[model samples]
Target: MRRAYSVETVRAAEAALMQRLPEGELMRRAAAGLAVACGDLLRRNGRVYGSRVLLLVGSGDNGGDALYAGARLARRGAGVRALLLAPDRAHPGGLAALLAAGGQVVDGPDGLGVLDLVVDGITGIGGRGGLREDATGLLHTVTRDRTPVLSVDLPSGVEADTGEVHGDAVRADATVTFGTYKPGLLIDPAAEHAGALRLVDIGLGPELPEPPDLEALQYADVAALLPAPGPESDKYRRGVVGVVAGSERYPGAAVLAVAGALHGGAGAVRYVGPGADAVIARYPEALVHAGPPSEAGRVQAWVVGPGLGDGRGAEAAVADVLAADVPVLVDADGLRLLDAETVRTRTAPTVLTPHAGEAAALLGTAREEVEAGRLAAVRELAARYRATVLLKGSTTLVAEARDTPVRVNPTGTSWLATAGSGDVLSGLTGSLLAAGLAPRDAASVGAYLHGLAARHGSDGAPVSAQDVAEGIRAAWRDVRAG
Candidate 1:
């Protein structure tokens, strides 16, 4: 698992560690790492010696880090220049060290004639909103020149805790973060600006708290969570998933959902909806019912919604599934018919899967707001519905009502934006729930496989919903093999 700490937590850990170390030792360690990364980047472009390196220095420790790094580069025969945004507030010690090493300070943007690399130390994790007008203007020139930028910690102007970018922010080709990952580096919108991330350990791990604010699962983690059966296990001993989806108008939704369930490690799939005939045609293995979910016989878990339209039958089916004693997953049209009181009172776990638009409708807010602040929106939805909420998008997040670390899916691709992809995800996750995985684990694992499957299917081209569902088996094998 990849863990990310909030700014407040990171600050506290840094403070605790700094108190125990020598006065300037901590900063020196950070600068050493930064300078090494800069040299490596310069070497990749050409040679470190005689390379033109420009530092965008601000009024904080981030500026100090860049200045000290510039001093190191100067000593190595690189032509280092510092463009101090705040001359009076710059670190005095770092400034003296840079001058001693033959580093020069440029007075204006005109001094930024041509550069091999630009180091962004304009703002640190504590800075909020966006870049100031003066800094933004200077960065425009750098951007125009298409110079590769390396941010000190994170891309300036993005919230380290929430990953929200409100205004103009520096777009770095790469970032060398200190100690550990920040939420901004992992989440989207802000993550889009943070090109590539490298972590330099400064030995602050001992001071940080257990159960970080956010976590992303890697291959081994997903492999452990995947369901496996023994030789003695029978179909019943494994798990059965019940799916209620599709209307006469949208029978394809039911077919896609069943396809996902069949490949999601379930022993059998029992489907109840108006699309029974269509589902039967596609998958004869699936057990079909013509009535409500109550008459669908025994099932370990139920997946409701998908292509269910806004008719009386669809609403009634949703209600019937929600009242069941087994775990239930609601998606698509089912999300529209949800009642807060009914879901909150459920004894079994409930999982709500919604895109940004559906999530916005649930919260009675705008889609733009939910998209911009996905971390907050998903948490709020989980608390409001008292369930495990999966907010699907570029970064699929799974959050529970409890105070556990939110899971951010790292395998998502743009190709998953295809229609019926979400329906497939709903059925897959529901199957995991039937197999006895917790709501959080099921959602996270389902998303991980769903994304990997998309990648396997796409391979860089467009892929359909059926292609994604069919690719799940390959994704499963890949995870287990690892």
Candidate 2:
């Protein structure tokens, strides 16, 4: 697991580490790592001898890191210029060092010549809301050209703890983070701006909190979490997932849901809905039940509502599944039928998977609000519904109602916005729940696999729902291989 600390936690850890180190040692380590990365970029661009590098300097230690890095690059033959946004507030030691090494300060870059790369040091962990006026103007100047930018610490103006962009934030070509990752670097609104991330170890020890406040599971972590069939395992012993979805109007949903469940490592899929004929036509292996959810029979877990209508029938179906006292995944229209009180009253674990629109409806807020602050929205949904909520989008967030840490899924691709994708995810997650993974694990693992499958199915082209389902086995193998 890759842990992300809250800004307060990072500051606390940094303060503790600072006490043990020699004067300026931590800053030196950060500056040295940053200078090396800049050197690599220069080498790749074929201009290590005399490339033009511009640094946007601010008031905090973030600016200190950038100035020292500029000094190193200047000594190494790179023409470095530092744009001081807060001239009076600039790091005095850093400025003097850079000047001694042949670096000059510009008030702010206005009509300045294009540089090969721009480094953002406008804000760090202590910043809140948007960029300062001077910083925002400087960022606009760089955006006028194709000059690639590397953000120091994090992209300026983003909420370090929640990944929320308050106003204008710098969009970087890459971000160089010090010590451990901040929550903003891994979650979205901020994550969309922070292009690629490179961590520079500043030697902050494990005295930082355990189990992390937030995490993004890397391939190895996910690989370890996946269930492997034992020598004594049989089909029945693996697990069975029961699905209640579809109506006569949207029969294809039931078929697609069953298709996804079949590939989700579940031994069997029991379907209960009016679309049994359609499901049987597409996937004959499913055990179809045309009757009610109560009589559909035993299952380790249940998935309710993909294309379920907004009538009494949908509500009744969801109530029946909730009554089953098994792990349940509710998605799409099913999300609309949920009652907060009913969900809280349930004895079994419940998982809610809602896209921005669905989540907006559930929270009685505008969709834009939910998209702008995904972490807050997901947490609110989890608390209100008393369930594990998966807020799906570019960065999928899994938040549990209980005290467990939230896990942000970072493997998103634009191609995943295709129709019927949610149904597939619902099926896959429900199957994982049935296979005995906890609600949070089921949602996170399902999201990881869903994104990987999209990448495999798209191969840089358009892909349909069936293609995503068909690509699951390959995705499973690829994850396992990792």
Error of 1 at 287 (Å): 1.0
For each candidate, what TM-score against the reference? 0.97, 0.97
CA lDDT, every model vs. true structure: 0.92, 0.87
Error of 2 at 282 (Å): 1.4
Residue 154 miss distance in model 1 (angstroms) = 1.2
| CA RMSD of all predictions | 1.4, 1.4
List residue ranges in candidate 1 displaced over 4 A. Answer: none
Q: Mind giving the per-residue lDDT tens digits that candidate 2 earns over 1-482?
A: 77898888888888899899898888999999999888887788787668989999889799999999999999998888999888899999889989999998886676568788898888877789998776777788776777888889899899899999988899988888999899999888899899888889999856588868899987887787777678987766777899999987777788778888888888899999988888888888899887578798889999998999875588889888888878989998888887778888888999999999999999999999999889889999999999999999999999998877899996777888888888888898888888888888889998999889888988889988878887778889999988
